[model samples]
Structures are given as structure tokens and as C-alpha cells.
Target: MSLSMILPMSAFALAASISPGPVNLVCLSSGTRYRLSQGLIFVTGATLGFIALFIAIGLGLYSAMNVMPGLQALLRWAGVAFLVYLSYRLAVDDGRLTEGDTHKAPGFMTGAVMQWLNPKAWLASASGIGAYTSGNDLQQVLIFASLYMPICWLSLASWVYAGAFLRRYVQRPQVLKAINRILAALLLASCVYLVLE
Candidate 1:
């Protein structure tokens, strides 16, 4: 791809990756609730999942939706249900700062599976692919995915870092619980958009 194309593609990738979504919310919660290293694991899985999804969309998975319209509905409802389940878990976290290590962080498989089930991930990949790529240009798609991988990881990591930073102040169980509830609410709101659409 040309410089012009690459810049736009990179910008799109940055925007999509940095924005708050289910993956970022989980990363943030994980950071607040567990170790930064644990959150990074989820970050890695999410980034890799996004890269895979983006490349698939670029290669023709997005077109598959057109051929099988029901697939879109299936994905939509599944994403919504998954988000609701995640939100419920986030909202009910009762651990204190001292118990951070005791509370399990979301694993790599959870992150990857969450990305696959996240409506935001699907939309971002489909829209970015549609805007930046030409018809089945594998080279361009690969280039975009390469650019996206690091950007996505770093962006999500920032959320984790932010949560870790908050950990210093929100040392009380009550405060941490409030934060989790807020994140959960935001997560639920995110799925509402998917449902509405």
C-alpha cells in the first residue's frame, strides 16, 4: 500500500483499538483486580484475535454475511448475550485490594473468545476492512493487519495501565466494587448499541 493508504489504515486501526469496548473494559477490570502481567495476557489474546478477525474480514468473511444473512443475526445476539454475562460478572466482583492476586484474571482464551463474540470487534474489523482495502488484496490486508496488531495491543494495554494506576487510590473493597460496577454498566451499554442496530 502507498503512504497515503497506510496512514489512513493505521489511523483507523488506532481509533478502533483505543476506543472503549468489551475487551478494553475487561482489560481494565483485570488490571484493577489482578496483576498487570495477567491483564497483558488478555491484551495479547485480544490483539491477536483482532488481527485474525480483521484479516478474515478483509479476505472475504464480511462478504459471507451477505450470502448468509442469518449469520449476522446469529452473531449479533450471541455477542449481546456474551456481553451481558461478562457485565454480570464484572458488576458482582467483591474482592478487596489485598485479594487482587486471589481473584483470577481473565485468561488468553477468554480474551480471544470474547473478541470473537464482541460486536464491537466485528464492527470495527468489518468497517476498517471495507474502508481501507480493495477487492481481496491479500497484500494490503496483511499490511493492515501487521499495522493493527501492535496498535491494538498498546491501546488495550493503556487501559490496563490506567486501571493499575487507579489501583493505588482505590484500595478499599467498596471503591473497587464501585469501579467494577461502572465498568460493567458501560459494558452493558455497549451491547445495547449492538441490540439496537
Candidate 2:
């Protein structure tokens, strides 16, 4: 691919990868509630989700999904329900860290599974594949996948770690509550968009 295409594609991927969504919020919450390592685990899961999504997209699953109304509806509803459930949990969570909660980081597999149900993630990946995938051969697709995963992993992990670090500076109840409220609202709003989209 030419530099012109590569640059724009990279920008698109980076923007989508770093943007605020339910997954990002969950990672931030995980970081704040537990530790940075836990937050990274969530990032790992999300990365795997993206990898799987890209593979499926490469294999024409998304194209198939687009033609099947029933499958599309199922994915949409599942994403909506999952986001709402997560938001409710965040909204009411006391922000109280249990003893040794640092050791309780989320598992990578769980994070990966969560991404499957994330509407924003599906939308973003579909968008990325449409906009970025230029090469047609197996090697080219593999190259695309190889380059995409680590960039995604690092970008997301950084956001989660930033959240964990920020938590140290805002150890007041009011501030934490405000943060949680903001995140919950963002997640819910995203869910509304996902359901409608």
C-alpha cells in the first residue's frame, strides 16, 4: 500500500481504538477498582476480540451478517443488553476497593468475551476493515492483523493504566462518584447509539 493509504488507515485505526466506549469505560473501572495489571487483562481480552472480529470480517462473516436480518438483530440486542447491564453495575458500585483487590484483576478470556458483545467494538472493527483493508492476498491480511493487534493492545492498556494512575490523585468520594457517573452516562449513551444504529 502507498503511504497515503497507510497513514490514513493508521489514523483511523488509532482513533477508533482510543475512543471512549463501553469497553474503555470498563477498563478504566477495572483499573480504578483493582489495579493496572487487571486493567491490562481487560485490554488483552478486547484485543483478542478485535483479532477475532478482523478474522471474521476477512472471512466475509460481516458481509454475511449484513444480509441476515435475524443475526443482525440478535447481535444488536445482545450488545444493548450487555452494555446496559454493565452500566447499571457501574452506576451503583460503591467504588470501595476490597482488601487485596489488586490481586483480583480481570481475566484475559473474560475481557475478550466482553468485546464480542460490545456493539461499539463491532462497529469500529467493521469500519476499520472496510476502510483499511486494501490488500487481497492471505499474506496481506495476515500482515494487517499482525500490525493491528499490538497497536490496539498498547493503546487500550495505556488508557486503563492512566485511569488507575488518576485514581491515586483523586481519592475523594465526591470526585470518584462524579467519575463513575460520567462513565456510566457515557456507556449508556453509547449503548443507545449502538441499539439505534
Candidate 3:
């Protein structure tokens, strides 16, 4: 890829990764509940998942997706279901620091699956690859994925850190519960938006 192509691709990756979405929201929630150390695992998984999606798109999966309308519909519904489940989990959480709470924090697989189920993730990957690369060149696809992965990680980690910072001030159980509830509501709202969109 040329420098001109790299510049626009970088800008798009930054914007897409930094934007508030399901993945970022989940990262924030994880950071608030578990802080950065554990939260980094989730961020890593999400970034890797995005990189995989970008590679798939760049390797002509996006065109295949366009041909299969039913596949997209299935993915959308799956995304809605996953988001709803996440919202419920967040809503019922008590925000107490239990001995096993660390284990309860979402792990790498959850983060990876969440990105796969996220429609915005799919759109961003497909659009970025489509706009930046020509045909299904593996080299170009790898280049795009390589550029995007770090940007995704940094954007998500920033959200996690922001949540960890808020954790310091929101230590009270009631306040933490309120914050979780708000985050749950936002996740639920995102589900609705996803379905409607």
C-alpha cells in the first residue's frame, strides 16, 4: 500500500476503533469492574477479533457477505441476542468485590466473541477494507490488519483506563451499582439501535 492509502486507512482505523460502540462499552464495564490488569486481556481479545475480521473482509469475505443476505440477517439477530445477554449480566451485577470476582471478569474468548457478534465491528472492517484495498490481495489485507490491530488495542485500552480511573471515585456499592445499571442500559440501548439500524 502507498503512503496515501496508509494515511486514510490509519485515520479510518483510529476513528472506528475510538468510536463509542459495544466493544468499547464492554471494555469500559470490564475496566470498571476489574481494573486494567484483567481488563487488558479483554482488550487484547477484542483487538485480535477485529484484526481477524479485517483480514476476512480484505480477503473477499465482504463481497461474499454481500451475496448472502440471509447471513447478514442471522448475524444481526445474533448480535442483538448477545448484547441483550450482556446487558442482563451487567444489570444484575451487585458490584461487590468478592474473592472470586477476578474470575468473574470476562476473559479473552468473551471479548473475541463479542466483536464477532457486533454488527458495527463487521461494518467497520468491511468498509475499511473495501475502501482501502483493491480486490483480495493477501499482502494488502495483512497490511490493513497490521495497521488496524494496534489502533484498536490502544482505543480499547484507553476506555478501560478511563473506567479504571472512575473506579477510584465510584467505590461505594450504591454508586457502583448505579454506574453498572447505566452501563447496562446503554448496552441495551445499543442493542435496540443495532436492531433498528
Candidate 4:
């Protein structure tokens, strides 16, 4: 890709990476409940997942989806189900700050799996790959992924930092629970939007 082409591709990656999606929301929740160092695992996993998806799409996964119409629908519904489940988990959090509370924050696998199941992630990957390259050029795809991965990680970390910053002010359990509920509601709303859109 030329430098001019790369600029537009980078813009697309930045917009998609920084947007309010399931991965970002999860990172926010994780950072709110865990230390930044611990939350880095989730960020890493999510970034890796996005890179995988971008490569897969560039290598014809997007074409495959077009060939099988039902596959898209299946993936959409699966994403909806997963988002609903996550929203429920967030909604029911007790917001207790206990030492060694491993269960409180979601782990690396959760972050990785979330990107695979997220409709927005799929759409963004497809759009980026479809728009920038021929969708079968491995070299261009690798370049795109390499550029996007760090952008994605840094964007996700910003959400985590925002949540961690809020944590300091959320001294009361009730307040923390309220914040969790709101985040859960946003996730649920995203589910509805995903289905309708």
C-alpha cells in the first residue's frame, strides 16, 4: 500500500478501535475492578483477537460470509446471546473490593472470545480489509494488522484507564453497583442495536 492509502487505512483502524464496543466496555469494567497491570492481559488478548479476525477476513472470511447468507445471521444471533450474557453478569455484580478476587475481573480468554463473538468487531474487520486491500493479499493484510494491533491495544487501555480513574471516586458499594448496572444496561442496549441494525 502507498503512504496515502495507509493514512486512510490507519484512520479506519483508529475509528474502529476507539469506538464503544463490547471489548472496550469489558476492558472498562475490568480496569474498574482490577489493577492496570492485571488488566493488561485482557487488553493483550483483545488485541490478539482483533488481529486474528482482521487476518481471517483479509484471507477470505468476508467472502465466505457473503457466500453463505445464513452464516451471517448465525453469527449475529450468537453475538447477541453472548452480549446478553455479559450484560447479565455485569448487572448482578455486588461491587465488593476483596483481596485476591480473581472472579471479579474477567480473564484473558474472556476478552479474546468476546472479540470473536462481537458483531461490531466482525463488521469493522470486514470493512477495513475490504476497503483497504484486495482481501487476499497477505502482505498488505499483515501490514494492516501490525499497524492496527498497537492502535487497538492503546485505545482499549484508554478505556481501562478511564474506568480505573472512576474507581477512585466510587468509594461506596452502592455507587459502584450503580455504575456496573449502567454499564450492563449499555451492553444490553448494544445487543438490541446489533440485532436491529
Count the clashes in each prediction.
0, 1, 0, 0
lDDT, model 3, position 25: 86
| Cα error, candidate 1, residue 174 (Å) | 0.3
- TM-scores for every predicted model: 0.94, 0.88, 0.95, 0.94
Clashes of 2: 1
Predictions in order: lDDT = 0.87, 0.75, 0.87, 0.86
Candidate 1 lDDT tens digits, 25-133 = 9989988988888889989988888788888888899899889989888988888898899899888888476544644678888888888888778889888877888
lDDT of 4 at 28: 88
Question: What lDDT does model 4 reach?
Answer: 0.86
**Model 3 lDDT tens row, 62-129:** 78888999998998899999999889988998986443468778889888988889988988988887
Which candidate do you rate higher for TM-score, 2 or 3?
3
Please give, for residues 1-197, the per-residue lDDT of candidate 4 as tens digits: 68998889888999999999888998888777777776788998888988998899889888889999998889889889999998998899888755477765777777788888988888899888878887499999999998899899999999999888888778677887888899999999999898889
* Ten residues in sequence with the least summed lDDT for candidate 3: 95-104
Local distance difference test, candidate 2: 0.75
In candidate 4, list every pair of residues with a backbone clash. none
How far does residue 48 in candidate 3 sit from its true spot (Å)? Answer: 0.6
Q: Which residue runs of candidate 3 sit more than 4 Å off their true CA positions? A: 98-100
- RMSD (Å) per prediction: 1.5, 2.2, 1.3, 1.4
